[model samples]
Target: MSFSRRAISLCAAVTLSYGVISPAIAQAQDFNGIVDSVHTHAADDASAKMAPLGSYASGQLAESAAEIVAFHAGSKRILTVNALSGEIDVLDASNPQKPTKIGSVSAGADKEINSVTVREDGLAVAAVQQSNKVLQGEALFFDAAADDLGAAELGRVTIGALPDNVHITDDGAYALVANEGEPSNELDAAGTAYVADPAGSVSVITLPAPGTVEAATQADVRTAGFEAFDAPGALHEDIRIFGPVNHHNKPSLDLEPEYVASAKGKAFVTLQENNAIAIIDIASARVEKVVPAHIADHLQVPIDSSNKDDKAELRTIPVKGLSMPDSIHAFTSGGKTYFATANEGDAREWGVEEKDGGSGVYTDEVELADVIDNGQVCEGVLDDVEAEALGDKKVAGNLKLSNVSGWDEEKQCFDELYAYGSRSFSIYDEAGNVVFDSGSDFEEITASLNQPGVFHHNADNEDPDFDDRSDNKGPEPEALTIGHIGERTYAFIGAERVGGIFVYDVTDPANAKYQTYINNRDFTVDFDEDNYDSTKLAGDLGPEGLAFIDKQDSPNGEYLLVVGNEVSGTTTIYEVESVVEKEPSTSGSTKGSSNLSRSSLSSR
Candidate 1:
């Protein structure tokens, strides 16, 4: 099933003439029938100008300096979140080939910055979590155009706890913050119970009008709380509410806002752990509704559910995947708004680890084999024929599932199995109805490439072992951004684990076509987590955030995509080229042939 690199390159070159086709045309031609007109370009086709800023503390997790990133067009500066140092690293991005670190902005020694956003006029706002994350956080504003970036603090306004992400309105009139409200892992003083969890909420900050010097203050800040959903029957049963019972027993505390996307006067916040989206009325500072995300059915679309198969093996299984999206973006087309999400799944695992002298009481993850051995699975639920198919280690036995769901209370056992993430991206309407989902395409596309020795399919960020992450979220698509180029709109999605950026043409939200996949890492390098070296041959790893710079705003005057790689502690700038469609020839050959060879879509 593996193809030579030369053969993949040849396939990519020949497919360049056939631009993306609409879903209707693809269906009419009886195409492979996944997404329409999928294509994967050669590595040389999408080369990037990367700036590898070394890690904060080598060989340590969560110590890498770079995470989320923001670009200020006015100043041509790239502001990146250095969580380890709790500061924003400002880089002069005027030269895309060689970006230099100029200065940094910090609220204080005790503040930890989570997210940042910049306006056209050089106004930068950062979401700062307090030293004690349970306490109220703050939104600190700065004038990035100032001569001294570090000393250009404009002002600060108090917000909710653990403000994880911030986004500015298109008109620059407001700043919306998604306060995650994560609880501390430590137990109560008595060491026998959990403490009260902080309620998750969103804060809307009304920025000063255009050409005004006035700064935003506490009076301009309004909080949107989730208390309205605390009542019984307020939340959908599908929306997860499972956390430490003592602390997160209520929907108000269980729902943690992860990211924010806005359109018109409303904001859509992703509650990752809850597997839902919270709609907020910005002007009124109220949560209108919480809509549960769609569960991915693997029975219709296959997935690689095993790491022990020794190669990329996709198969259908009796399991459902939760679309716990981590990042979301909103765009309007045909007078209607659509939200695109990277369905990177998540689980609720809190409290100190057993290795750190505390019980793992809040973890909800379990393996299928362990669930069966512990007698938690319902008897007679799986017939002998069905059990035999999923009983081996190379099958569904080692697959990870959530222990908090699918419980049959009356029977005291589980009736179904649930996995973490959908391993794809989806488009949803304003009402949260799924318009289109890239079902099994991520894994299928990656597996089809099969680049030997380098860029293994479904490999982990720290290691190049192929199919290593099949048992978990395969090719986890966590970072996402949407941009409009010419008459078409494209969505740039980053796979955090497999280390690449996937481009999709989403002009027609319901008929998104895959454009290309690009990964810069050289897998031959020896990447040992215990003795890591950022300056080695390692490329960008763990893409956590993506910012699209239009041709007009781009420093180099070309469409640019800025990525923040958290694991390798690097920020890369990729030049994006629009795909030009060619008219079909008048020859007797079929124009949109479904019988096109699969090698034409293979990537290297």
Candidate 2:
């Protein structure tokens, strides 16, 4: 995985044929380049198919019992973060269809376990945050295969505040942690702002190689901090640096590290609130550069910007969106590394008196109509046609926009309106340039599906009301991971709200194509947490994390996609198959050819 600059062409292939070709044949031929390029070690007509295999329920609804997940190959076990119980629940996946809870790991009484990962040798690491998240956290290690499962402690190392995510390299040489230093809800003594806001950072720990009896210590921890960006003008103007001023009054405190994806001595961190990606030199433990994420133009990428519209419909609007990516994963394609992100937007609304019992309030979210009524928007910001459309509550008027961005200081008003999350997934090159984006494809594809009772476009995970999350981040692509099957690389993305997985073939980063979309949720169930029946086949809901197991490590000798559903507290295993599509019959009847349903949406 070396970093190299290359020009990626986005031109569509021209079709100039003499014979009359059927649309299906033409479409199949269109994928010839992609199919031919990766089929050196695979079948030429092979494509991916995914379906549910099994599920294990914690019986804890809406409690976030199952969030992050990792697999232990040697032990034949699956580890998931049970945030509600503050523990790691270990399951025996030797029998993939009936994975039962075998044991659990606890980092003492009051610690909150946010993430967990396992090395190839069955060594497990869990990121533990303090009860008060603003305080410093720690990473706990365990022998995952111990008889009592997690009862054998391997080691522990002190980390930064609120360690939200942890990852181990394939070689198991280093462990990376994202310390999301969030602010406390309590107000300061002056009652003007938050009590404390710690500076966010990334902790890189040098771990002992596999089979080593020694453990990582505090001395092995090296922090990648943002102090260098604290200087004025160091951060780009496009990188968001707003919210109630922290006590430290440094830009470092405002830049929270949300997720990390590393490769070849370089780590790419998602600064979700800042709308940027910070590249870190892992060897030097220093910030290299912060690349601002693209702000999507709604006119070109249509969106459903209003929940009040009473239906799910994509429309062109006069607005831009901040692509605040949450989870990112790195993969190599054509000998170059590319990063894929789930552009799940977020809002910084902290210390609300009613919600958190705080004395003060701090938020950057405001309604588009509110900004207009308050005279915070410029007089001629919207054209006559744009004004009429945006003035309707069923359109962009009810959409949520960031008040901290698009401000014209000299004019004392906002010249442009910005929304949260682009509501899609994107592929970025080494330089953080957008190689490809699934612009509005997630919403449109989900809406076109015939899954009437199971899924509703833009609906919340807990409530199946249509268009409920439209005004917010629709579908909210938050979970992401990459896998290789049959010489082709695929990116699996999960929608946090609608609760499903979208698969794409990224063998060619510039020409990624959609493969399939599968969701296990049975929306017909009355989702009442208290009286919910775990035995019912309600399916998994609120997918928070995804892990892809190659066929070599799979228990059933098949590719597997594991999903940890936060809302339903269930961990599901989906068997992925690479099937060869059968050619049409000579009698003109084509049926049951094993060809998976591919999305018809156009690529960006």
Candidate 3:
């Protein structure tokens, strides 16, 4: 549905990029059941200003920042894994805004550490992929005080192809690792499928009691429920297949475990490509169930599918897409376990090269003609002559959906398959049932406040590619972490493309309330269209990992939010406070009742 300007002005509280709207505007706005007034919790102390009190520098060109974890050792410090340099840099963050580099540790020469988890006692586990080859990764442990490479090593356990994520249980008894055995981009001689089997699994690290940290053993849980969950396509016709020629491979062989979270003796692992979540019993090191998180039907769900490069306008299109979650984190509230994911969708490619001589958009124009035409529900997009002209245009290989029904002549909808990600954050119950989804909240909120010429701009660069990211993943909510302050629970979702943190009150997982949005990137400067310098861009860019330190654990006794920006190679920090004076958005009387639509809650 096209949002009228009057509706937008009426429903949205006018907000500037770096400033809050007037009290009258905040009071006038009514977002149906959504939060109306949003506020920023900047640091109260003069020493720390807004977000990014301080930033730790990493690599310049290639994305060096990956994951980060904060723990109080001696004083509060932050540990960040630089994927480009393969170094674990330690920073002194006792002061939130003015963090200084204290020490550094290396994973190896060229190895990339995907993730790190630190316990209260300073025992940390890092998932390191030694080689690009499948199954060459390992789980490495380090004592809290150990600094140098050799001195930090406590023990090492061999894992699978690619250890994508690692998390230590709350009690520190076990550490779970998601080994994403992703297939190589190299295709077979026939150019039909991947060369290596993309079988992914989880590894459990048995940690000794409180004192004996050196005695640790790793268990590979790949074979658990291998037959049931990862059966061949013949056994389950609905199984997702990337390409047609991979019929010889089984689903178990291609289920790449993307991220993992552990709570109450169980680990929740997300299989991004397979669109499933594997619940693992940590004690037995077995998979209980591989629940399929199905496709998001566009018909019921309202999504913004218009090209992001267009001038700052949001068009909520009804198009189906796969909800391939990238980063998953778990939390608990009111005796029930809940988890949230940054649905920054992803896909794989290998068979062919792009005609444009670039890394992205590997499919040639001719191959995408049918899908793009099918992508549109209306008529006349693809005539006999237009089909011949499409050979000159290029599109991404996976953008087109394979199973979309031919265009509906009357309704004028192709039922075209959208991209992979839900482009928002989702909350799931313990049984993997959908509780709440942020829906077009990210798109709507961002579009309402973003400055002109910067909509859907990638956070990584100074050149604002206005509306460039809208076609793919809008905002691309990549990093998610939840923290509790007083009786309220806030979920912070980092938008990788636009460079901001979306705050939502998920205290009630069933009906989460949007709290506020905060971004520290520098937005005052204009884009230097000629020679682009990413560092000069406003605000931090490419937020890859987020660490939410509670008020109690925080060094300054304030709620601390740490974000690692991958493109700019820096770890930015924020001090936030929750000011709850108004009633919850879900409880009060609302305007625009029709606007309160259930987010693509589940694939029907």
Find the candidate with the highest TM-score and give its number: 2
Q: List model 3 lDDT by residue over 129-161, tens digit each.
A: 976757568777776556453477777778777
The whole-model C-alpha lDDT of candidate 1 against the native structure comes to 0.75
- Whole-model Cα lDDT of every candidate shown, in order: 0.75, 0.77, 0.61
Highest lDDT model number: 2
Off by over 4 Å in 3: 1-51, 72-75, 147-150, 218-225, 232-239, 351-416, 453-462, 523-537, 581-604
Each prediction's TM-score versus the true structure: 0.86, 0.87, 0.80
lDDT of 1 by residue, 368-444 (tens): 77776677778876665666557566876788888877878798888887898999898899988998887876776
Tens digits of per-residue lDDT for model 2, 89-132: 99999987667899999988988999999888877889999999
Q: Name the Cα RMSD for model 2.
A: 10.0
> Which pairs of residues clash in candidate 1, taking residues 3 or more apart in a chain or in different chains?
none
Q: Per-residue lDDT for 420 in model 3?
A: 63
Model 3, position 348, has a per-residue lDDT of 58
Prediction 3 global C-alpha lDDT: 0.61
